[model samples]
Target: EPEVTQTPSHQVTQMGQEVILRCVPISNHLYFYWYRQILGQKVEFLVSFYNNEISEKSEIFDDQFSVERPDGSNFTLKIRSTKLEDSAMYFCASTGTGSPEAFFGQGTRLTVV
Candidate 1:
């Protein structure tokens, strides 16, 4: 079965630095989303993109963050300036609709120093 894939399973960056986390969502999926989880917190939705534009975004998606579908398969999240609070596991997920069973990539662990 096809699956979502993420690169650099773990990343460490200094505060105020920029980082681009990459993901390749499932080929036939329609909706794409990014969610993050702090060490002991609940998974928080960051943004959801579809039809090449943002469909829904949470308050946590601030000016420092942006997402892009650079190609047919690749989706990327760029943090203009990282902060220590940004340290978390960023999961790339996709589903055909807004259902509870979205498939998530293993995730990219971001550790801001």
Candidate 2:
């Protein structure tokens, strides 16, 4: 079965540096989402995109963050300036519909120093 894949499994960066987390969502899915889980915290939705534009975004998705579908299969999340609070496990998910059963990638661990 086709599954979502994320690169660099882990990343460590200093504050203020930029980082781009990569993901390849399930091929046939039309809805893509970014969610983050701080240690010991529940998963929080960051953003959702479809048809090449943002469909919905949470307050967590501030000016420092952006997302892109650079190619047919690659989706990326860029943080313009990292902060210690930004360190978390970022999960890429995809679903054919806006359902709670969306599939998740293993997750990319981002550590902002």
Candidate 3:
């Protein structure tokens, strides 16, 4: 079975720096999403993309966060001016057109200092 893959299992950045977390979702999946778990907290939704546009986004997805399908197979999440509170495990997920269950990537652990 195909699965979402993320680059750089871990990353560390300064509080005011920027970072791009990359992901390659399942080839056949259409809906892509970005979720984050702040340590022991629940997984929170950041944004969702479909048809090359943002279909939905949570308040947590402020101007500091952005997502793009820069290419046919790759989806990316970029955080600008990172904050210490931004440290978390970011997960990339996707689901097929008719499926409600999403397959998640291993996750990129972002540690903002």
Which one wins on lDDT? 3
Query: How far is each candidate from the true structure, as Cα RMSD in Å?
Result: 1.5, 1.4, 0.6
Model 2 bad stretches (over 4 Å): 97-100
Name the better of 1 and 3 by lDDT.
3
lDDT of 1 by residue, 22-49 (tens): 9999888888999999999999999999
lDDT of 2 by residue, 1-113 (tens): 88999987999999999999999999888889999999999999999999999999999999999999989998899999999999999999999755557889999999998
- Selected candidate, larger TM-score, 1 vs 3: 3
The candidate maximizing TM-score is 3
Provide the TM-score for each candidate, comma-separated: 0.95, 0.95, 0.98
Cα deviation of 82, candidate 1, in Å: 0.2
TM-score of 2: 0.95
Put down candidate 3 lDDT per residue, 15-108, tens digits, no spaces: 9999999999999999999999999899999999999999999999999999999999999999989999999999999999887999999999
Q: Considering TM-score, which of the candidate structures 2 and 3 is the better prediction for this target?
A: 3
In model 2, how large is the Cα lDDT of residue 104?
A: 92
lDDT of each: 0.94, 0.94, 0.96
RMSD of 2: 1.4
